[model samples]
Target: MHSLPDVSLRYGSLQVFHSLEEYKESGVCKIPGAVTLGKFDGVHIGHQKLIRKIMDFAHANSISSIVFAIEIQDRPILSHEERAVYLESLGVDILVECPFSREFMSMRAETFAREVLSETMHASYVCVGTDFGFGCRREGTASMLADLGRQYGFQVEIAAKERLFQEDVSSSRVRKALAKGDMKLANALLGRPYPVMGIVQHGRHLGTGIGVPTVNVHPGANKILPPDGVYASCTRLPDQTIRTGITNLGIRPTVGGKTRKAETTLFDFQADLYGQTIQTDLLDYLRPEHKFSSLDELKSQIGRDRESALAILPDECDRFYGGPAFEFHGQG
Candidate 1:
């Protein structure tokens, strides 16, 4: 198996691919030498290795790091904005998000190879995963692509599948791990912690009145949630500051609420965080979500939850909590 490349590309300062128009308008791929690549669903660690190879190959050969992928019609597990941001962070020079529809899906593998890969992308080289398949019933394989590369005058490089702890690593596997609250295994494969980002909204303010302030975040409807439970999480505020908090992900039982919502109460935080975008990374699972009859019951459980959460939080956070410098935002 060919060694997979390293994927430690810094994302803190890269331009993201948001639209096809933005990509074409940039004219970056119009350069004499340009390589094209795929849909890259999760842009997960394995995908990163492939992308890194493409980027490195492009740099060494003076080719544009053009990535061809389906943008719409194919529902993304991650929002386009989020996926684009992550890909950009991985240093993809040009990202072409094609609309993947029944029409595209029904096209012959030959047509996809010639029309999409050769004509539309004008790619000098194509990179793909060994198990990659395309067309109706997913007919195409790496060998077929290699055959096309021979006929179309472009090169094809297939990346070896990535593995972790002797097991193949994939988005599906990571998803399963997350569903089971296996954060360590998931993070080990993801190369970083999984974070849920969303804008904070106004809740009933019930927790605040009880001295347990909380931030309400409406996650992307389709976004996967860790089994409804309380988690020890780190919340990243817009200002890039991170705070430790205990987050409840489930229907509110104490106040007779029926909707399943995520409520995060930042310990020792007294800021109004309404309308702020924040991200939470679940570090540990505390317990399965449950229903309680009374406010007192819920409050008592929360108190215990806070104590447990604090024990799990980094020591530095405990020292900083309630300090004058630890100012929070939102309606105070």
Candidate 2:
């Protein structure tokens, strides 16, 4: 196993390869390097720890840090585009996105270790979760990788498991939290706010008539919505400006609404956002969606929700959002 040193952690540049052939064509990852492999669905705290360790080792050893990951098509936490941006924020130099197909899934553990990690990635060191397993039918384990590292000439390190709320933090557990509308738990495990990106779409102008304007969004498919509720949100508009607001993720049960969507009441915000993409960082879970006896009653509740949104965000939201989400780590 190769030894490594300590270095200050900071994110630098990023390059992504959609295929192994494209990666080799770029003439990168052809020499010994530090690599971390995972699906990294949510890019949660546990995943961050592994990536940071690998990046640190790479920086210390004077080699490139590559993220060799599988892009799971079904029910993924973050899309490939979003995941690449997040990994770049963590200082990964190269991102090797492998298409998760039937043939790739059927590849044996030994073949993956020898062909992909050893030959293609030229991995000098590899870091993965304690429960890490891969290859045909989940036949590989952390110990199996460690043993193969000796044969293939690379070092293996199992990331220490992280815990919150007295349970192991994991992508599955995070999804469960979102299902239960526990934003604190979900966001805590994610190491950042739950990210939901969508394009602003037209909806019934019910709020406008009530004197409260809202932006309706059509979320990208497979985005897990949090239990149909009202939440405090940090929104990024298409012009690259950040705004704080309150959002409702529901079928609009109140006033006989239909279809699942998110409506945002951007505080002191006035703009033409129709047909533009907006990314919302849900910060705090407020209240669950409910049907009111009348539109006036619903309007009153929204007025109160608006006041609460103002108090939840930082005093200067514009400056706060200018930094990476990782800066807001720990229980607050």
Q: Best candidate, TM-score-wise? A: 2
Tell me the TM-score of each prediction against the true structure.
0.80, 0.82
Model 2 Cα lDDT, one tens digit per residue, 105-184: 99999999999899988999999888888999989999999999999999999877988878888889988888888877
The segments of candidate 1 whose C-alpha lies over 4 angstroms from its true place after superposition are: 1-39, 61-63, 71-77, 311-332
- The sequence of per-residue lDDT tens digits that candidate 1 reaches over residues 1-332 is 11111112323334344554565566654663345455665566787787787788888888677766665443344555455555665667666666666687798888878876676566777778888887667898888999997898788898888988898878787778877987667666766556666678888888877778788877667666677889877776656456677888888776776776778877666677787667666767899888788777888998888778777665423432335556432211
Give Cα-based local distance difference scores for all models.
0.68, 0.78
Root-mean-square deviation (CA) per prediction: 6.9, 6.7
**What is the alpha-carbon lDDT for the whole of candidate 2?**
0.78
> On a 0 to 100 scale, what is the lDDT of residue 249 in model 2?
89
Give the poorly placed runs of model 2, Cα more than 4 Å off: 1-13, 19-32, 238-241, 253-257, 314-332
- Candidate 2: residue 264 lDDT (0-100): 88
Give the clash count for each candidate: 4, 0
